[model samples]
Target: MGIFDALNTSVGGLQAQSFALQNISGNIANASTVGYKGIGTSFEDLVPAAAATNRQNSAGVTAHSQATITTKGTVSRSSVSTNMAIVGDGFFNVQKPVGITDNIPVFNGVTNYTRRGDFQLNANGNLVNGAGYYLLGVTVDPKTGNPTGNVPKVLQFQNNFIPAQATTSINYAANLPTKPATVASTTATAGGLKAYGGLDPSDFSAGFNPLVIGTPAPPFTDATTSGSTVNNKQATQISGATLLSGAASTDSIITNFAAGDTITVNGTPITFVASGAVGNQLNVTDSVSTMLAKIDSITGATTASSVTNGIITLHTGTASNLTISSSNATAFAALGFASPTTQARGGGGTVGAGVVIGNDIKVFTNESISGGAVTAYDATGTPVNLQLRWAKVDSSSLGSPHVDTWNLFYQANSSATGTQTAWINAGTNFRFSASGALTSPSGSSISLPGVTVDGQSLGTQTFNFGSGGLTQYASTGGTATINNIFQNGYAAGQLQSIAVNNSGLVVGTFSNGQNLNLAAVSLSHFNGTNYLKALDGGAYAATDESGVAIAGATGTINGSALEGSNTDIADEFTKLIVTQQAYSANTKVITTANSMVQDLLNVLR
Candidate 1:
């Protein structure tokens, strides 16, 4: 072996220690850098060919650099929305642009991978990381929200307006009271009966009086509060001592009668006989009152005959179907009686008491019922107010027609004919089951067609109240509660901000309270991470050793945050101390080797 062999080996040691120190300095410098992978220097020793003597001096040491790319770093938090981190083995696909301006990244074809994720938006609205690398992702269709292609591109957030959406469907959920409020009280008379109470089951909205028919006659009772009382036939009457007293013993005789004379009261005949008859036709004198007693003797006639001062009324026998007619209409009129018309009780036929039929809709005021309102949008994105009122119909008592029917009325300010606080017929009625759940208006969906809003048309909007949408259980606190109300319509919205999710989804939020997916972040994985070439700013490039990068092989993508540097500062410092000492020791060895070589040179001289 040459005497200077030791010197050469020490020189190699010095160079190796210097290389390790450089790695330590780099690690320490980047301790706080985001997504930085620390470098560790590995040392290898070379030996000269073995001699037959079995001992040979060592050759110089060789140092190589390896990136701790596979090692995971502690996850720390960041405020930037575009920031992300990797939890396992993978790298973010990024493009390092050739240049940048106003925070905008200039894209270069060169693709790189990184553990760094401190990304921010640039002037061109491109997402760029702290390393000046543009974030790469798949472009997404604004209309479909799906990936446009497998080819990745630099992510850019553009300042654009979101187009308006027309209302297609509306979802509605609310609790309609099973029992509605009552209408106002009103009074009227029918069939000579005084009537007053509710128009519906709870309150009366309109008043009706049978006095409307004409002067109520005798035997016609007062119209009761609800037209539930009996109504009888009637006629105007007059009775006193002079008209009733007759020629014989207080018997009536107002006019002399002939044998052929006849008066038919309610289809029954009163035939007058000649003067020979005794006690016939109630003294046969034809007095106004005494002769009337003879007429009451007919069937189905309730005669209140006192032979004096008793108004002829309430002729009831088997039945009181009273109608007075004769061959000559003048004959009944001549008896001090107007033409007797067949009588019909109120609410029976043409009596004309207002009552709806066959679930017909009717308008009612909120003063007599509860109401609600909702804000709806139109084609032009204008808001319209729709007001609704609930009016109870039918009865509160239980049976067939158990009285749970209701009428819902609505009015909008955008109505073509103009709006009124007074409810307008909505063309439908809501009926409820006895258990208080809605039964009619199947599906509980209502449609408002041809509605106008802010002078624009808003087509038909179907409001799905769903099954069991309404109820009438008694409760003290009521809020007109709306479980949910949403429409598929919106005005144009300005882009507000962007966000990323762990699934690598890029979302854009707008001012109109809508969020949309804009793009998708892609990741790359290598079969041999250590074989990847290290690039500037904690990045890597593909090499033959790294193999083909598999796209979409990602660890968890943390958003609005950054991944911390893997380098431990204290550990780097320790390495620095060891490297510094080793370097010094290597230098000392070189000097000692030189001295020994010089000694050999002197001995040879």
Candidate 2:
């Protein structure tokens, strides 16, 4: 052994302590750094292979620098949504620009993983962390909301408008009153108000129900005829009369009639009953003629009625003193009477149709089942309000419940491309089950054929009324009420915001009410993370000792949060004290060794 072996040993100790102190400094310096892995130093004794044969037993000490990569940092809340932390062992795949190649961000195809998660959208709309590395992940298909492939790439968000999607399906859920609204039996036909089955004199609107306009095999005549059979174009007697807007029922006067209904003509009470009676109490099924007779039987009223082309016209002998009012709330509407309107009395005859009428006919809209209205979008992203009205074509009394039918009519602006107000038949029968549920023509979904709203031709749209979505239940006032409705269509939209989910998905939300999966964050797991090579930023490169990077998403992602440095300030300070004391002891050992060497020289002299 050399006489200065003690000095060499002490020098080695000094170097080892210095290296440990360096690690302590680094650990303490990065305590607040996000996703920072603390570095630790290990000491080892250096012994030559021939140390047992050599005189010198101990050689020196050396430092082994290693990263505490396996240690998990404290995950804390963050204001940024893109900031994310992994609870288990994993690294975020990131790409850094090594240089520009052909004006592209060249990375030399080097794959790097990082723990730093201070990610933000850069000027180019790329997610770049604080370390100037772009985050990479797998892309996804918007239509299916599924990941396209496992291949990784830098995620870029474009600010262009999200293309408009035409409405393909509509989900409608509703509860329909089993019966129509209640009506009165003894209703006095007043002026302005028209009867439920009355014909319209002025018909400016097109798109009336085909059944109403087509010729009835047997020409429909008086008020007893079904209103659904009367069309303005019909060559029959009602050919000139505009079809009434409402469902056809036995009460042609009113679909639903209740007892105790009465009519007051110039202050005369004409109540209804179930049997033969006059002035005392009228029969519930009494016709307009019976009502006029009963009124004539009274001294206060002198009533006259004419039923032509399905319209019931009524007037009093003394028009000046005649005022027909309902004793019940529904009686007036049942009689189809309103404020006295100036019915332009045509001289003695009617129009070319020869339909007898005390006064000219009126124009009216048809009755509808009212499936409710919804805003539909066109191919070009134009929006329009579509009004739907459904009217009963076949009633349960005609045949089996399953055979009962209804017609759907849609109205929008006919003049404007996106605006339609004229009703057009949907050309589909809404059939029902014996139980009163919409069962056929397929209960699963109703396919409305091609129809133009505004000027845009929207393709066939499917309506999923839900399982048993339509139901018919009897009530005093049977009214159609839509409970729920939704459509899968949207207009053009711009990027609104971005969010990260626990599944490590970077989702971008658009103003058009769409949350699209833009990319999935990539996680790489390593077997020997400590052996990974450190890079300029807070990233690590793969090494043979580290093993191949395993694509891992098993780690729980804490979004809107960051992982604090694993370095503990208190622990680092303790290590710093220990390192400082050890350094001092090494210096003292060197000084004492020097003194001993001097004494030996003195003894030799």
Candidate 3:
């Protein structure tokens, strides 16, 4: 070989060794970097021309090329809820802010893809990297748990809240006890019968005439006069004709005996008798008065008696007067009077006669009373108890017939006292005012319109959380605003589970009694993932030949685990010795070529 040829060969060897050293340096630099792939060098042959019978060319050693970078890196897990790594072929998409004027782009926008999983929220409340670069993915509806679209969504805390109120109206029933009867006088009779006092002079003098004697007739001789009693000693015989004679009887005289005469008749003591014939009659003065004397002893009446000439008078207790009238002689006979001269009739008929009966008896029916008021009772006549429940709704969800949000406020029981008052403020929280006039905070207020309770719809309700902070939404076109007053009102929550799908959807579960779509992580895959350029800190960037990142997940490229570097110390040392030997051999070739050139010069000398 010519000296120049030998020199070129040695230079090629120097270049190849230098290239291998550079690759080794790179590998050592990224030995600890996550997802780091080491690089290696390759050598190619150079061609030279030689003339012969049939001219042909031969190949010789040429320069080295740093060709492929093997992606033989180890995968270690941090086990963090947010920590993620692509095991196979994909990359996590990220977007670094271009400037102050540009907002973070979404998935479809200009985004840089990486494999680094370290993520956190930035000061602007966006989930980002430590460099403040925003992530990209498909956003989802919080309530429906479904994808909205491929857009970048920021995760944040929710703060729209208010209070609720109660209800009114009540009913009842009951029974009442019956009343007893009362008694007044013991003297009151059962069937009513009374006694009369006939001895009363007032009774006799009321309307009767006085008794008198009649004139004597012929065939009768007078035996005595008013002042003298002697006669001619002749006994005059009085005949029936004298007794029957109208003129002698016209005076109604009981003349058989004179005044002050006495006789025992019908077991009663009498004093006068007629004087003309054998059938002489007696005239009893005030005969009814005498009968009244006997009745007075049996009843509660007072009696008195007086005598004048041939007449005796009697008086009774003050009531009405009794009179004996001549027209009532027949009635006198009905009273067991034998002679008109013995008994007399009265005008007032009788004294102290009618009756009186039954006293003090109860008269109406019973009625029911309850709850300090009157109300209709049940079939068994018992008072009934009542119960009530009150709840609020989301105004927007009301017209939809499906209740998305509801909060219960008050419930009525038997221990409840008075009227339940519900305060519905236009832009404040709900307040419940009880019968005792006490007010208290209630449950969460619903912002949705057209909410209903027990099938009754409420158009919309206004409520407030704190001072001057209000939420007003109607079933119509009302706007709901949650102010800073309620910003501090948050229900407690915690991280539960995490899940990811091929679409790069990230769902986080919470211990706050809810399952929420917390966030969606960015993801991408390259057509030539093997050719992707690795940067520091376990990250990768796309290049022209990496072929426009077709976004995908880990398993898409196949379930192949990335094996760690085969850069064993022994193997690298042996390779280093081999490269040094080749370098030394190339230098020897140059030395030998110089020696040959020296020999040629000696020959020319």
Best by lDDT: 2
- lDDT (tens digit, per residue) of candidate 2 on 420-449: 234555556666666887766664676776
**Candidate 1: tens digits of C-alpha lDDT, residues 1-605:** 46578777888888888899888888888888888888999999997887665676567788999779888888877777778887787888888877757755566688899988888887778887877888889978654688999998887788956777667556666665443333332222322111211133212122221111231222332111111111121232344343322343332223334455665666766665555543333223444555556655653335353321323333434344455554434434434345553432222122312222222223233223445566666656566666555545443443454455555545533323212212344445566666767777776687766654344566777767777656656543422345666766776688889888877888888887778788898888999998899888888999999897997674778777777878988888888889889988888887887888788789989
Ranking by TM-score: 1, 2, 3
Give stretches of model 3 more than 4 Å off.
Answer: 49-72, 98-109, 125-134, 151-515, 533-544, 554-577
Question: How well does candidate 1 match the true structure, expressed as C-alpha RMSD?
Answer: 10.0
Q: TM-score of model 3 relative to the true fold? A: 0.39
The global Cα lDDT (0 to 1) of model 1 is: 0.61
Give the per-residue lDDT digits (tens) of candidate 3, residues 1-605.
55767677677777777777676666666555444455666778776765674654433464443423334345544534444555565666776654553443344345666554555544444555544446566666554557676654344322311112111111211111111011211222332110110011112122221111111111111111011111211123222111211232332222223334443322334333333212222334324333334433322235343222323333323332222222233333333222323222223332311100011001000000011211211223222222111112111222344222212222112222222212111222232221211122343333323323223333342322333222222322111122222111113345445544333446555553444564566457766765666554445567887778775555331112222333445555666777778778877877887888899889977
Please report, as a residue range, the 10-residue window in candidate 3 with the lowest summed lDDT. 360-369
The residue ranges of model 1 lying beyond 4 angstroms of the native Cα positions read 51-59, 87-89, 99-106, 141-144, 175-374, 386-455, 460-475, 501-503, 511-513
Instruction: Tell me how far the alpha carbon of residue 546 in candidate 2 is from the true structure, in angstroms, after superposition.
Output: 1.3
Go through the candidates in order and give the clash count of each: 25, 23, 33
Worst 10 residues of 2 by lDDT: 354-363
Error of 2 at 367 (Å): 6.4
Best by TM-score: 1
